[model samples]
Target: MTVTFPHKTLPWLLIAPQLLVTLIFFLWPAGQAIEQAFYQEDAFGLSREFVALENFIELLQDPYYYNSIGVTLVFSMAVAVSGLSIALVLATMADRIIRGQMVYQTLLIWPYAVAPALAGVLWWILFDPAQGPIALWLEYMGIEWDHFVNGGDAMILVVIAATWKQISYNFLFFLAGLQAIPRSLIEAAAIDGAGPVRRFWDIVFPLLSPTAFFLLVMNIVYAFFETFGVIDATTAGGPGQSTKILVYKVYEDGFVGLDLGGSAAQSVILMMIVGLMTVVQFRFIERKVQY
Candidate 1:
């Protein structure tokens, strides 16, 4: 009475839709982008020149392009570390609290559900240098806080905004990791006269490493690629070009400047950077994961 099916064919059937969608939506566009990188468009929006690597050479030689790369790396690393650290601390604290845990968890994780663009808009209202809540507060305290001109303040805002958006996601992952640890393990450690620090180091941290590794990669990816909205809203690459991350630069070059070919080169470089980073992260973390 059991139905038999071809397992080999079943796997393809299950993945056929995804593969087709990927081909149509991702691979096709990627191919087009590569093609576009080699051609220059004129005023009439026609491909006027077959430029080969000319666009790429220009991008490589541009100081603004190099500066954008530096800004992107700095912002990405700062957000990743700060977000993961805060999330880990908050997760650990939440795991220990007994009263109103659900309320606190809901509040902490709610930020993850909000759209990044919306979050950027909200922060814009809160940190406006002239008259926003935070800016006004600074002024009231007789503090001179002008993010518009100061690169450091702009970078700090970008990092803080990016980190705030991602901490909830990291928290959710850490919370799940914490919940998966068996109470019996902690009890056994306690029975063996292990103190809080000893138990955490000996047992808790080892179990949490998997979740931490996953969050590290995810947070880095989000901070690198997805914080463009916040940058666009808050700095627009800024008073100068201080906040122009690679993605923002790509958008600016392609759409704003209409230097589609140069932007495509930038895009290709960004793709390579992200792809390399992901490969490196996987190589390093693959050995550390338990299961």
Candidate 2:
């Protein structure tokens, strides 16, 4: 049965709220950022000068900017890969539960409901060099764990916080994808002498390509943009700028460093990078998706 609106304007009315929100939140801010990128302005906005591409050129020449780019790449990849992999494993385990399924699933998904900053603070306390239990355990194991002065440790800390925050969301999607696979197919594969691993690799995983692809895009975006709170709360892009991902750099420059024009330029670049990444994923990666 095909249901159609009697008037063409009815469909527009149904989507008007969403369109209004997009305009107010996304498009308006994006336009402001773009406009600001072209001008050098003081934090107080007392003086301004139009400097076409000067901010961008300065960023290109700055070693710290390059470092931020590299850090962002590593952080985003670690978050996306580890978050998806761990979530997939957890989802598989959750799907196998014969009883208390909802309880287990709820526990797994609880992390996603936590605010990003809160999640970062939770992990920050867990890995505190002085009092954190995990840090003490690592010390007992002869591994030095200190995010305060150690750059590598700080990177790892932020990555773990970001990945942990995203796992529940990925798990929900993965569990749904796993559950959607027909049991008959698995039973047939089992009868054909295919083990659980074989069946999963050959059938289950391929069927999950669509969900994985979608999560991949979302995770990358999250790592790039939404993890700012996580970084700020935990590391503040500290340990000599080791964990300063691009988005945090925008905040650091704009709000803290008082370089509004440079910050806006960075924001514009970050937006373009994410846009290009999404385009590339759909162009190349989607080709491998089964559906």
Estimate TM-scores for all models. Answer: 0.91, 0.94
For lDDT, the strongest prediction is 2
- State the TM-score for model 1: 0.91
Write down the lDDT that model 1 would get: 0.87
For model 2, residues 19-76, the per-residue Cα lDDT tens digits are 9999999999999999999999877989999999999999999999999999999999
lDDT of 2 at 264: 95
Q: Give the least accurate 10-residue stretch of model 2, judged by summed lDDT.
A: 3-12
Residue 143 local lDDT, model 2: 99
**Candidate 2 TM-score versus the reference:** 0.94
lDDT of 1 by residue, 70-174 (tens): 988889999999998899899989999999999999999999887887777777677788778898998899887778898887888778788888999999999
The C-alpha RMSD in Å for every predicted model, in order, reads: 2.9, 2.1
